[model samples]
Target: MNELSLPTSTEAAIRRVEELGEALKQNFPEYVFPVEHSLHGGMYARTIRMPAGTAAVGTLIRVPTLLIVSGHVRINSGDRVYELQGYHVLEGEINRKQMAWALEDTEITMIFATQAKTVDEAEREFTVEFEQLQNRKKEISA
Candidate 1:
């Protein structure tokens, strides 16, 4: 209805999304969507490769980030469900959790403008619970 609904209730939406993510993790095998990181010219890009039909959930974004969606996917998000295709690029101030199913093999990249010199620094800059969940993800997925 309204374009990019800003989560009817931020906390409620967050809890709902996180609950779904946890349930998916508990019910299904861990689907490892390989993540690639690169830093260049005052910017950082985190690219995730997701297989078709697989689902994923993302953390809260701490800042304005650039989201580039390649291939086809349906993101049933906290605010709305976005069916995106091709190489769509948008700068978003995303503030909640994500639940996405890849319609086709997909590449989703989050680019950030950063002065940080290392990937670790850039991640800490953008992520809310870098030490808690993000690091744990790297460990589990590695």
Candidate 2:
């Protein structure tokens, strides 16, 4: 049996995510992760649509989250690469960067834990992941 493996090192994962994000951005300039709903206090969900043949990279999340993918996608979750189609769900602790390619037009919903009082606050939380990772790197370098 052939088992698919993914990049497991932190540095390699980060680099891959950065490259994937840039490539995706160049191809899908209008791609955006908008909040889809709030799941009770300190929890929120956001969704992004990836056109077929496009890919996206995600920042390191400090907390565990749920990922629901609609349509076909190939995903690298730092430890494994999964090829999924139709409606699929992934839930785990996602403290490392990840990348995904849309085999078909895909809508991905990410549900995460946060301490935000409103959608704006939750969005801010989402944007700060990269900064947090950067700070961690700086601390390691110093």
Q: Write the per-residue lDDT of candidate 1 for residues 71-137, one digit (tens) a residue.
A: 9998755567889889877656656556678999999888978999987788788877666444457
Instruction: Tell me the tens digit of each residue's lDDT in model 2 across 102-121.
Output: 89988988788887887657
- Residue 54 displacement (Å), model 2: 1.9
The models' CA-based lDDT, in order, is 0.76, 0.68
C-alpha RMSD of candidate 1: 3.2
Which residue pairs of candidate 1 clash? none
Give candidate 1 misplaced runs (Cα > 4 Å). 1-9, 132-142
CA RMSD per model (angstroms): 3.2, 7.8
Candidate 1 residue-wise lDDT at 16:
78
